[model samples]
Target: MTTTPGAADWRAANLANWDERVPIHTAGSFYDLPAFVAGRNTLRDFELSEVGDVAGKTLLHLQCHIGLDTLSWSRRGATVTGLDFSAVAVKAANGLAAQVDATTARFVTADVYDAVQALGGQRFDIVYTGFGALCWLGDIARWARTAAALVAEGGFLYLAEYHPVADLLGDDGATVENDYFHRDPIVVDAPGTYADASAPMAATVTVEWRHGIGDVVSALTAAGLRIEFLHEHDHSHFRLPAGKGIPQVYSLRAAKTA
Candidate 1:
């Protein structure tokens, strides 16, 4: 089914998909809530070095799946708010926060595009959303606008995402069988997630929009954010490489100068 560009169907369907995943994710070992409760920080070493000191900064994580990263920021002294479109995910995020005794962290339910407005124009010291975030968004321009709006002056956006190049490659990581760029959405009907290929899921279908790396940078720059640094890495936090090292992920740090 082709989703109309302006229609809410795509958003609603994606929301339902994520809501269904919350339970499976909670029961699975993917998020590692127990490890978090045991004082493990989910923040990757790369992000820690890039996002910089979150201490005393207001951090906002948009499209926050279950809030592990958000609570981690709170653990490091940043007052954090995690936002997602799925009510189930938001609830689970809250539960995770409480489990970790992160009293300062908060979670809210909202689409990524609507996040800034939902927060009542509240911008943050550090606006972060990446790592599988770009594909879910059909309009990179609009997404960039919301991201820029959420950045407090002098503050920036820390985006660590799976590289678009990997999106075109198959699981084997050797064949390029898909389009490298797409202006329309791709519908996927699948029973499992990247975390667990065998886990039973209620949300078996999802839609994604592909954006090239250049598209991402252009959108952000057009939205008035300066690209501080963009780095490509051979290691991916979520991927077990199918073969030799290739650029699997990229992280960008951008700040608003306008």
Candidate 2:
């Protein structure tokens, strides 16, 4: 089935796919839950540097799968709350927080679109997201609005994401395969999760959208956030072919000056 962008069924398909992957992810070596619970921080070095000194800050993490990053921020002294649509993931996150004794960490199960209301209109000092997150959203502008609304005055939104350019590259990493400008949903009906590709998965159909750097920047600005910086990097968590010098990942920091 060809899933179109903004289709309710597509969202449901994505959610089902994600929900089924929770257990697989938690068990797989990709996430390394054991190391994480043993105090290993999964956050990237650049994220740590860019976000800087989260101590005594309130942070809201959207689409935070299983709360690893959320708890990692909490360990850095931020009062952190993670939100995900997958209830199973949320439960696992809460469990992980308990195991780590992250007293300031909490997890909520809700779609990103309903984050503001789900959190009772509470704004945070830092709104954090990304790491393969933007592709899941059908509407980037709406996402920006939601993220902006959840940011308190003087706070900022930090996004660390896989570059959309990587999507354009084929398996060989040199050939142009996908369209970067494609705004519709890219449906992938396949087996296995990213964490464990060999592991069998029931919900195989998933939908994704592509949002270019320009799209993301414009959305945030239109939502009233000032772009602080847009940094592209060569390294990625995934195996992006080397020597190509293509941007594998990108980070953006947008602030609410008022």
Candidate 3:
């Protein structure tokens, strides 16, 4: 069951909702700061291997919550800039960077739609985003254009996201809980977040869109980016329901045309 709303309204509501979730996610165990300090690569192997070498490349991370993965890229020798809608997330990200002694990375607090204008024509060798990112936006085409606009002529854009199919399933284990093909916003009135299941949360609402694989590919293609690759897997970063098992790799990557 999806509640449809106008694109603008949906986007505005989502931005505000994510703003509140930023701190909860940063302090959550799923992001395990102690493990990260011990040199564990929080990113999956598929993403790491497919993204290849970033040595000396300029990388921009979109919706970079708390900057953990963005700092990880910087540690691999990329000059990195992270952008997110939440001011608190950017502050925490900057603080984490200082703590990690990562001088090559910077964090900017801005909505993705406005970042290009704020950046003053700055572009990057790689524009990257990760799981659970795309749902926040109401317009996939606009998001794709934003991504393409940020990539330099010879550079590329990369994304590794959860499969849309997995999103349609219900916890009841026998039905489709949501509309998979709906192009409108689905309102979720819930407590707590996906990051910290135990934390109590205020009763808040959020709007999300379920973009199918074709929609994703078409949006990027319409934005003039050639699809490099699209891989699917059985697993996701967090656990799904019964019969859903972890894959050896649960990531996908697609690069822009050269």
Candidate 4:
């Protein structure tokens, strides 16, 4: 329930905490299930146009929280599998899939780092990760390798994440605050959770890591995936800071070369 202070301990605690947050997220207003049910695409326009045709493709969505987007891909005719570190998320995802009659989508519970091992030798046509996902990862290079390894030759990896530039600006509601470069693991002692702002959370300390633009690109390239395109935009899914204005999504594409 509570995270310890050390790095290794923090990871486990974070994973456990995320597991608890999944159900809360599923019922939260932020996800807007009614809108999703009304055929709205939760994905950004840049992400949709970049990944393009998923019809008949096998897609893997990593770090899928409750699989709204994963099921959305399945609706577009992609055989989709969603993976998350939280058992609760997987359970919630599976429930939503059955409810929405998205029989083609499956959910798996496993840490991103151990996904390859936990998922056997499954490969996919598209490897997708999205906003707010990378910040939780401590190792960018390893994450990239894991993503690349899961893609079949000619398949590609797509990510639409919060711009690292935006992250440099702290959430202080005023001026730019934090450093852009990857810093020592961020440790926060808080009494509440991000998913359920109103719920009373046990005073728990959590840790997070920051990965810069270069770190993201170089890591993917080093994993033997060729860069297709990288597009940065001007509107994020959520409001970020004041002067930095609203954050935009960065769409990155990396292809596995033969």
Candidate 5:
């Protein structure tokens, strides 16, 4: 595991890389910005059921890029605040909200570690993070603790993530290319991204950390959240096929049952 001090370099690299991806992601059909502007919610079916009613709830979406999903939550009557480390992404998110004329959604540009101070002492009924988020951070323990701190006393954390098993697979999305149990950073410098593999990328290098379902549960529990339930699924948000009979994604529901 990269120590807190050593992870700074990797985090900076990741931040720069992500900042550059914002415009590309917003332009891509994968995000479907027009659909969002047309009043469509980007969240998947299962997530809605798992998260239950957000009507009149306060929701904080961490690592929310460009606010599509975050605004969707606002449409469901949740007072939403979308947070991301990239300024460009946050700017675009705010722009989308303005374009859609959504009043309940807000965006904040800040790192996951600084979320509390960035949000001005606000807490939420639901602390949400979705697919492709956890791998960017070197510290799951700290990440989970921050999530707990963001949750209101009676609220919970709702997470949907690409399964560790899915991350281990090579580009073919079939052959295993890495260890599932490794709690270490896997430094990568590649050209394409998951959203649009063919799109040219200026920021090619990035660092990713791997965490399994067990790691996720342990971190949340260690941080004082109660284990509610965990379920694995065979589908993913991306267009690529979740390899036959493979569990490609996982959902975790934990609570601050104080």
Candidate 6:
């Protein structure tokens, strides 16, 4: 039987689910930790271009899993800090940093909503997030406020994520199967981690929320960030079905003018 959780109980369920998957993801081929430690960069090409030169700048990565992308920024000459809700993931990230000799990189364990306080009110020249992150967050407005608070003045927040439209498509990747503007909590009871589906897992129940493009832009605007650009792409980190393809990914850059 599938386990169902209440809307208010997403945090605990997700924490358990992610914590259980940490070891699996670490050892799986999907992340390819060996290749990563051998000088692979996990960041997407477009993300590198949009975020631009991070050299000599402070960059904070929210929901940074395992710190591959976080350490990739460090290799590019940025002073980097990564924060995640999963303690196991944070520990793995720290270990990866050591392996890569990323002396400038640090990892912290904290919920994204508590980022400001957990990081001791530290702000960064760039606040970066995305690649399946928005879906895990329940409130875009609250998230935007927190992200904006962490961005130093004249700095920016860059987000590169799977498009909400892809969530509406069925497995076939062409048929519309789910609501695009869904506001309720989505409870998913599945068998294994995305990295290793065959891997046994005890915590299968996870709660997710979908926020539209308008919702994200509006929230950031309300939080005092000026939208610089929003770009949509047909390519995605994960493969979609071979049939008709819609926009699979999107990126947005917002600057803290104040």
Q: Which candidate has the top score in TM-score?
A: 2
Residues 70-133 of candidate 2: C-alpha lDDT, one tens digit per residue? 9999999999999999999999999999999999988999999999899999999999995989
The parts of candidate 6 lying over 4 Å away from their true place are: 1-8, 237-244
Candidate 4 lDDT over residue span 71-92, tens digit each: 8889889999999988888888
For residue 179, model 2's alpha carbon misses the true position, in angstroms, by 1.0
lDDT of each: 0.84, 0.91, 0.78, 0.82, 0.87, 0.90
Colliding pairs, model 2: none
Number of clashing residue pairs in every model? 0, 0, 0, 1, 0, 0
Residue range with the least summed lDDT across 10 consecutive positions in model 2: 235-244
Worst 10 residues of 3 by lDDT: 245-254
C-alpha RMSD in Å of predicted model 2 compared with the true structure: 1.4
Clashing pairs in 6: none
lDDT of 3 at 22: 74
Distance from true location, Cα of 160 in model 1, Å: 0.4
lDDT of 6 by residue, 1-258 (tens): 233455457899999999998899999899999999999988888999999999999999999988889999999999999999999999999999999999999999999999999999999999999698888888899999999999999999999998888878877687888888777778888888778888899999888888999999999999999999999888753648423457888999999985
Better of 1 and 4 by TM-score: 1
TM-scores, one per candidate: 0.94, 0.97, 0.89, 0.91, 0.94, 0.95
* C-alpha positional error of residue 69 in candidate 5 after TM-score superposition, expressed in Å: 0.8
Per-residue lDDT of 137 in model 5: 80
| Model 5 misplaced regions, further than 4 Å | 1-5, 171-173, 237-239
- Which 10-residue window in model 4 sums to the lowest lDDT? 236-245
Q: After best superposition, candidate 4 residue 27: deviation in angstroms? A: 2.0
Cα lDDT, model 3, residue 193: 81
Which regions in candidate 2 have their CA more than 4 angstroms from the true location?
241-243
List clashing residue pairs in candidate 1.
none
Q: Which stretches of candidate 4 lie over 4 Å from their true place?
A: 1-7, 171-174, 241-247
